[model samples]
Target: MPTSSPQPPPPADGLLSAARRNLREVAHGLTHASHPPTPLFADAPRPWQRLLPYGVVLALAATLIPVTINFLISEYGVPGGVAGALGVAQAAPLLMLAHRPLQAWWIVFPADIIGALVLLGYPVATYTVWPWTPPAIVGYLFLLLALGLRETRRTSIAVWLATGAAGVVLHVISPGRSNGSALLLPVLGAVVLVIAAAVRERGDAQRRLAEQETISEAERAQRTLLEERTRIARELHDVVAHHMSVITVQADSAPYRISGLSEEAVEEFGSIAASARESLAEMRRLLVVLRSDGTEGERAPQPGLDRLQQLVEATVRAGLPAELSLAADLGDVPQTVDLSAYRIVQEALANVVRHAPGARTRVSIASDGEHLTVVVANDRAERLGSPLEPTGTGHGLVGMRERVRLTGGTLDTGPLPDGGFRVAARLPLSPASPSSLEDL
Candidate 1:
């Protein structure tokens, strides 16, 4: 055999390319307006609760705006119009922080720079904080908190770094000014970012866990469905395959058993035997497909309505008082419907016994020429047990529904007003035709 050619080595990214990619990511994070706004009073039930955040923001604005404006005008000798504009710019973004934190930061960061520049030009008080005033610091910190809560860690970190960088630039332009803000804002913002990011991560983890649980539940249901279908197929094979085998054997022995048969008759018997054999072979293939690994075929014959009385008596002995009200003349039910009816009643009784331990139950089977109706209903449990018991895998109903569906029937199940449960299934008595099966 010829040796395979060696695969080409993957190309590596250069330092310049890596740096460019990182820069592009940072720029995109800063510019993109895709982050969802954190919900205000997300778990609150009342309208007032929903408006609480807005009320807080309004209170802060009412206090900070006039104070900032007065400080800018009185302490720095800035023009009144300029002072009002700066105050509004710094304070208004705080209101926007709940819904639009990054955009608010964009506004407040530049305003702080300009405020610092203007303050640099005028006389400064000895006790005044430089670059970022008290109100400005408070508003920016709130904005940082919102950004950390809603935005990605990468984006939040970029904004945090950018804020520090702006503070540093203001410090550089105004030498001999207090640079405490340069250190203070970043440190305080870092702490806020860390806490908010932790909360965000926890929320995301919880959502992911819930989603995973939902997915697992769906998968389990689907698996249970397939398993139930396979079980039905296996039981049907046992019922049908037996008849086919018998037909084949009888057809093969017909020529010998009967005396003075014509050549045509002998040939006809052979053909019948051949057809039956072919059917048996097909059923065997289907059974093979339907069986799971290491599952042995059920050798015993499947139950029918004849066994319903026994099942109920057993349930009655099992602590549930169940009465069987089977019709006197149900006539001849189709084999599939017979098996399905038996299984439906069996499962319903099993449920009552498992869930409502001491409940009174009624199992009724009726046939009206065209259909066979099975109803298994139970009154409320007298025992100290919950109807929604956690003992079973909850696949009993699934199996019953599957059986009813296969028989081209309808099933209804629900809780009664008396805190009891009921299961009713209507199955066709006449054998289903190929066309009807296809329709089903």
Candidate 2:
């Protein structure tokens, strides 16, 4: 094999090494970033709530450890400065942890463990001064209590057992054997252990109940969405079906009746056909909306006041020559009023086209102080042949009545004594009323 060329030396200033090191650091940061950050605790008055009580226990150890060490030294003549230093050192780690509540448990727990070992691990006879007994079982018992509040059951239990065992064993192993109150210390320490376990178990059950409530809330939201879809379907079936039926009847009769008419009359029928096509197109659009599953995004427009003109033109084209007269210059009418006016005019014209194809229609809109009136009156058809509007479901009239009432308006439709159909509506223009904002 041919000898391989020596690999190029690393960048002169160690650029390659620096780049590789930076890549490793970025990759390490990404890995850490993916983990949910430990949630920060809000700055509450009791930031050290969980650990301060534990600090009190450490303080007792500090006071007791040095005093017990000094007393032991004076009585038994065993001495050292180690007891005083270790007493203060015990609380140092705990106070540091108190500054960051979320990070305290890991650091404080281990410090408590090491502090206990440092004070108690020596032989009894070796350093019998304050190091031997002053801090006592009190410090360790309070540590278990704090652990119960801050940690889970299994972990707290382990720490509790270990600390309690150390307390009882060290009591028995010490050289000063008091034969008088043998069971006293063991019985009190055992009670502390039982209290810690109960507190830990209750915390676990409360957490489970909170999780169940969150799941129930999500299910209710999904059910409400399904019910809303069903309501939309029923509205489309009733509204579109009635409007389309009226347009079809007028369109079919126009061509036959006006055969001998002038060009203008023929053109009127063509316009009516176009209007019917537009109404059907609008109904199809409404059908698409009703069938859709509304997902989160921008909303679509509905047939409202803005579409009033289209409604009036369609009606006029339905073989009824109609004149539109505004009462108070209705221009910037509220959308709600626009929709109501459109439907009123639409239904009135459809009826005129069906009942009196030859009669000219006049639509008058006039505002009278606090109310507006809309009137559509047409002369009766010149002659009657086969029934043009059979199977009158009457739903068209009923729907118009409902829409008027919904808008706080009153409507009347009846045959004129002169043999024509006349429809009139009066709608309130109160400031609180939705249609009162109409510009016209």
Candidate 3:
């Protein structure tokens, strides 16, 4: 293999091009009007809290303006008019510091340079701080603090470098002059800028965390809703699909069961049987889509009110003292109503066990021919034990509401006045035809 030729030395033009691009970027950042005003106490809850920042700024400006004007006029022997103008230029920017820091800096920086140049022409005390007066330094520090809070780190760094460069120029033009301010301003300004930038970074991190938490909550709720719907579909499929299958079988056997049936009667029964079978096939396909996975559905029959006694007995065994009172005559309850009532009671009891362990619980079922009502109430926990399971995903109430809605029913659930909980559901005995499932 041939040895690779040594890479040519980096071109001087490349370095110059990079420097020019950086300068243009810095100029754009300083001059651009795109930066929005940064609000003080943006998350303050009350009006008084929001107005507090303005009060502080007003006080600072009052003190700085008079002091600055006196210093420029008396110490530096400047004329009253010129000293007043420079003082106002330096102090007024503090008022704009909270909202428009960059603009304020633009005004104050030049004013400081001009004031220094004017004072240079006159005799000054050797002990006096030159270039940057005390009040002027304080005002610029405030401006830099706001700039760090509002602007990006890149912009902030550029601003700091510019300030240092200006200080350097002032020192060069007046060599041997007392240059304490030239050294002091840049060092102090750097500290203030660093602290303000750190605070801003922390606040941004917290806001992003809060937003992520909100998004996670929404996603969890959506997932719970889908799960509840899928479960409802599975139970109803077991109930309704069985009935459809029965209808198909009965229709097929009708002609054979009866004696001397006519041709027209036989043809009608055949049509009914065919329609029932087609409907069952379509329903199964719909169920497949509803299921979360391709696994087989529950093979066991869905529970109904007939299983309430066994469920209560199991609850009692599971550390919950419970009693059940069911009406003797429910008057041939519809299968949907029966299943929903059972599920509602089951979920309510489970909630009691999870949230209020060893609580006194009462489960009652009553019917008045038109509707069946289920109520599960528990007093405050008599004793707390390790829960039967870890805290649940808070979907119990959501499932109950969904079941009641499907059966044309109403649910009422809330904490009782005695620091207990109650879940009551009323399911219609004769619900309207389920048009919701017609597509299936």
lDDT of 1 by residue, 1-440 (tens): 99999998655667778888999998998888556675555556798887887887778778889999998887778899999999998887778765677888788888888888878877767777898887888888888888887777789999988888988787787757865977798899999999888988997898899899999999998898888877877888877987888999999999999999999999999999999999989888888888878988777898899998888887766667889999999998878888889988888877887788888999999989999999999999898845433222226999898888888789999999999999999998776656545522
Say which prediction, candidate 2 or candidate 3, comes out ahead on TM-score: 3
Candidate 3 lDDT for residue 119: 79
| lDDT minimum window of 10 residues, candidate 1 | 385-394
Residue-level lDDT of model 3, residues 348-429, one tens digit each, is 9889988999889999999999889999999999886677762222268988988888887889999999999999998889
Best by TM-score: 1
Arranged by lDDT with the best first, the candidates are 3, 1, 2
Instruction: Please give the CA lDDT of all the candidate structures.
Output: 0.83, 0.53, 0.85
Rank all candidate structures by their TM-score, best first, as comma-separated numbers: 1, 3, 2
Reference-based TM-score, model 2:
0.39
- Report the number of the highest-lDDT candidate: 3
Kindly list the per-residue Cα lDDT of model 2 for residues 300-364, writing each as its tens digit: 44354345456556655544467777654654444444456666776667666665665778887
Residue 85 C-alpha lDDT in model 1: 98
Cα TM-score per model: 0.87, 0.39, 0.83
Count of clashing residue pairs in every prediction: 0, 12, 0
Residue 319 CA error for candidate 3 (Å)? 2.1
